[model samples]
Target: MKPIPVTQKLSVAAQLQPDDFQELSRLGFKTVINNRPDGEEASQPGTDAEAAAAKAAGLDYVFIPVTSSSMTDSDVRRFAEAIVASDGPVLAHCRSGARSFYMWVLAGDVDVQGFSDDKLVAVASNIGIAPDASRAWLATHRRTGKPDVKGFYDSRTGSIQYVVSDPTTKRCAIIDPVLDYDEKSATTKTEHADEILGYVTDEGLTVEWILDTHPHADHFSAARYLKEKTGAPTAIGAHVVDVQALWKDIYNWPDFPADGSQWDRLFNEGDTFKVGTIDARVMFSPGHTLASITYVIGEAAFVHDTLFVPDSGTARADFPGGSARVLWKSIQDILALPDQTRIFTGHDYQPGGRKALWESTVAVQKHSNPHIAGQTEESFVALREARDATLPMPKLILHALQVNINGGRLPEPESNGRRYLKIPLDALEGAAW
Candidate 1:
């Protein structure tokens, strides 16, 4: 078997045959740890036969059966013991090699020289291991730093705009600002964006960046308007190019460039930037929209459209290019943040007509959010799909996308000096009647 090395002394592989044991020994593995239980599949060998082969090959063998359903602290302890007791290089095997790798991670104390815990967990997830255990480990070890946060509620759209600032430097970024729109009048105004500007001016805060979580469906982004007013750069997730391509087809804009040039910076997953002196990074949190992202600035996560207040539940994932399963995974990642990390959501429907509220913590969401808290992946998908199936398309979806995809700029004035919005008939199919 070809082994994928995890550390200097350890490597992992899929199920091994009796003939494979001699080749493993020849390759200088001093011990073999079997993480798969017997009879898992009809074609696989039993533990006794595998142990006999190892003995014949002059290599020590340790049996540590692990399954996704039955793994426990005791299993981790046994795996740790086997790892510590081994004299030299170890080759571990499981059905698909994920369980063996997972056990090694949970055992802890292994010096994966170049990997931080977050990076290590991401690596495990990429290799097909569920990240819950490691996510908990990450949350427990997260750094503690509170960045000052201010949320402005827009009663009209049920959206909340934010200004996350470094208290020491008084430097901040405006997130998901809205450009006021009156649907009946077919006009847009700067009232919402100006209010944010007023807050910045009064607080002596300098705007460093103007960011959008995604191309919004319900409201026009004020990224371009705010950039003109504050002179700060505008940014969005890099996958916006994908959204641009999709929408350009529906709008029939043959010459439109869909290369993500609309924004100043296109952020990729794990991309890091600074909000003043505070450390900030990007998490690609798509599902509500193809290009959605969450900005984890200091100890606060600007999780636009992924989650809402614990009382309000989560965002809807029925828009074009959205998926319930993908949204579930995105929410899990946000919940994986430190328990104390402040979660600022994009919209708050003010469910039950309660007063507008927009902030919650990771711990609160894990315990109180009905959309999460006890729901498995399968169950969550069922709930979300059923709920979304009944909901009508957002009233402003068509009106908002054209402007948002162009970085919040309204289309240029026509020959008569009047700007216009183009509405396509019969474009959105399967919308609620």
Candidate 2:
């Protein structure tokens, strides 16, 4: 079996045959780690046979079975402990070795080396492993990418939507497209979303996915409208359930389903997918909202609500389920991306009355962002909370959330044959305005 070396002392390999224990010992490996759960594959060898062969070959073996689909932080901690207990060089095996590599990456996620998924995939590919087994990992921790990113700014809510296109196949994904609503007259229009649809039509791009970073507070989501217009599926972060639960109590909607049944797909952390040839992944970036996620497509990070650009500082973590301390860590993760990685934020307030801008680089943010540059986590949290306390809640927070939390669909028509939004008095007690 060809072994992929992750480090001088640790290596990963595909399912090792029972007869391969001697070879592992001969290669100077002192311990073997089995990361695959039992019965994962019908043709795979049993752990007992592998353990028996390892014992006969004088190599220590540990069965730390892990399900690739449902890996947890505790699993990573256990794998790290197992590695520490091993003697000399350690060997880990899974169906294709990607899961082992992912574990190592997770164990080192907080380590100083900052091993990202881009680095992991590159190293795995060099060792003859196809590495599709860790698509979820790569998507969330992608280091470098260059998808064609175009932003559409909605003047009403100071929100920015995006149409990310794959250069090769002309397939695209719409991100955070807004459904314009006039709170004054309760008028709903598609002007904001139609602009993006027009761009897709003009470019001859096929709409494959209509994505939302989270149910926006400042604006209604055009996800349902766009899905109907383009015949594409809609998706959002899975933790949006937490947002729905919190809002349901405020609105007193006993019948609201907080199970994330609204969207066609509910993405968990590290989930990966594709838009044409461009690989996209999800990273759960809560704090600004309980379900905020960053879409890492190639080298571009669609960091919604975590950052507002260098001039405007970061997003306010004062909404329901928001945390300033958590937002600080989320911003740190975004800053960890490659220096040159293009960052596309969710909104731009056009501070100083300048033209709206939505693009920046990680390098730019780390060095120049007023909220980030020279600020430690504690300092950033203090600053963010102080600023959040003085800011008014988004004008559309109440009206938008009901529609946004329900996957961008307005509430069903009432007996009068028209939909209406329910506004709870004093529901947001801490709203600055």
Candidate 3:
């Protein structure tokens, strides 16, 4: 087979490939990291063929297979070491590039400060990867020195939702919260949001902003509910307009607002705001979807769904409008941050059936993530694209996108005064491609 061509370059460090080793060499990549395990018969080319091609192209190659449910911390650490020992731009690949991209994101030297879920997704997609799972994982892993902050996280939804309080002013702002939704009841609940509200009331913390990294696909956002209850402004990435536009068509909602006026604040790239003691900056990350963003606060970044616990790897970018090329770039930008910066993601599904583990140091990720370390942009892209080709669309894509694009609010009530979710028959056929 001929070498693959590079279709997207992730940040200044990564790239997406359609199996073009010559292009990788031409672009000055010296090493390749393969994240795909052998024998994923449906979507990937055989590992032996990839290794032969890499050697034939005069590049050093290493294969470190990482599965979604089986990766360990040691695996992540080893991968990071490989990147440190390598020379020149490295390319990492796996099915869909998410595994490789996440490994690199876990590798320290990346800054996720001010990146939102939608922004993370955008940046990830720019290089052809997905940030959804990674973004959620980031949130679940937040770290704080304040006892109140720590206590709050420990008590709430096994997730972190913080309101930074200034010593002088005691006022605070909330970032990325969980508003519990009862799927069986088809009704939204306020158990999680109420907890935060109680904290605000008891601690004398003034509510400022109800922030979200993106419209979460896996969980309902409590932004609207919180905003309704607290009168605080709810905000998200400005690119949510794009998400709204995309999902509006999918849901066939004629009444949905395409202009993005629904959100109190629609942040754009490089936007900044004051949230108590923290100055939140916006970074567009977007591989999981077109509207992901990251929020940078002080030395910590609420990265939402761009990365995971580092040990378990990164997010998935298989949803519609998601691309492996974009995810690679987003991860590169995150990996370029200060080494000690804490990267907090949105969710986690712990391996070993242990309690869900969240949080990973930037240093820890830089050295260990199995996917992206020691991989070049070109090679990583090729691997990601090939891998993504075999993935199936996310299970909750339709339901999630519609609600998420609306800033986590459900569709409007119909004539019967009940909201109904639409399922387009045959619309998703051959979606694995």
Candidate 4:
């Protein structure tokens, strides 16, 4: 079976491809669930073909097509039964990977008595999905008192990096990690990444993937550094090609490559992958940047640099290639998630004399975020444009973009055979404003 390209935190058999059953059998996924319905206006490889392939691959296959607007209790029950009866790890997939993920949450906690209340709410939050009526349904029906996993947050970076593991599975993946840097020295450090690495090593967790949400402009992406230390493959959103192009011209680097082939794997929206027991999917979320993406690990959405702490409001959209209108639309999609969904932001700049804080619920952002709360599209556009106009470029804008666009590697060696960075003469006269 060909390996499907999933989101960052999840792991899939390397040989598995979309609708590839033979490889799936070889890789030991005993069951396959096609969450995508047939006959949508969009062209898709039909479910029938996948079903036929699954059968040929000697795997139990089920088709539980779900529409975007409608997923019912009966659907949840059927999905749960399939999971319980499956002989081995299961593969569930759908368009944009969200529907399949929603189903996973539904099935994972279907037996709890308050499935519609507490358990469901907790699971959705754990996996970064917004809590809503659907989550309430799972919480109301939840039969288990103990959560399947636990989660934690870091206050200083305003990022919610997680350590997800199942005792039974012992499989784990770290998502959207913050690698602290020493700005004064122009050197890099790994205190944050080290903590994650220590946890994985101490707990005997196999680190499969070191992922980033995008080539961030505000904070450095430690994917390359972490990969070197952990021996994990590094990845980012595929649209990073667009970012590379944008910055390439801005820096006027004639020798730089344009196509976004920098990262090891360029994940597209709806892509799915695996870590250990967890399956993750990608949601193409732009606005923060041309390539910003959310990695949905199990039920959590690692929404990097999109929405900040709810009270702090949303991310800035004034960077090169960023559009306020597009950011508004992207945030709308995020807000549409279940209200209880956990939104792990990319970076946090603490305000109000508050301690650095990261992680917030969708409900909080929609209701209290000062910048975009109750803001109409037009109003948000106007506000964002005006605010952006008054803002100064990031202190490390030039340095950050050049390094990030190259997947975090510094410039190649010059004619002197030494890697060096250049500062354009007179590039910033009164431009400091």
Best candidate according to lDDT: 1
Clash pairs, candidate 2, are: 145-298, 145-299
* Candidate 1 RMSD computed on C-alpha atoms after optimal superposition onto the true structure: 16.8
Off by over 4 Å in 3: 1-168, 382-394, 415-417, 431-433
lDDT of 2 by residue, 1-433 (tens): 8888887678889899999999898989999999998897788888998889999999999888887666675676566656655768889889988778777765533112223345666777865556684554565543224466678888777898999887668899999989889999999998988889888999899999999999899999999999999999999999999999999999999999999999999999999999888888999899999999999987778999999777898998999899999988888888887665667899988888988877766755776688998898889888988888999988888899999999999999999999989999999896787
TM-score of each: 0.67, 0.67, 0.61, 0.62
In model 1, where is the ten-residue run with the lowest total lDDT? 107-116
Ranking by lDDT: 1, 2, 4, 3
Better of 1 and 3 by lDDT: 1
CA-lDDT, candidates in order: 0.85, 0.83, 0.64, 0.65
Number of the candidate with higher lDDT, 1 or 2: 1
Give the residue spans of candidate 4 off by over 4 A. Answer: 1-168, 413-418, 424-432
Candidate 1: lDDT of 385?
93
Q: Deviation in angstroms for 350 in model 1?
A: 1.0
> What does the lDDT read for residue 381 in candidate 2?
85
**Candidate 4 lDDT by residue in tens digits, 166-260:** 44466766666665655577666777778878877877877677777877654555667777887777788899888988777777888788676
Expressed as tens digits, the lDDT of each residue in 87-169 for candidate 1 is 78899889977778767755543423224456667766655556886666445433234456778889989998998887668
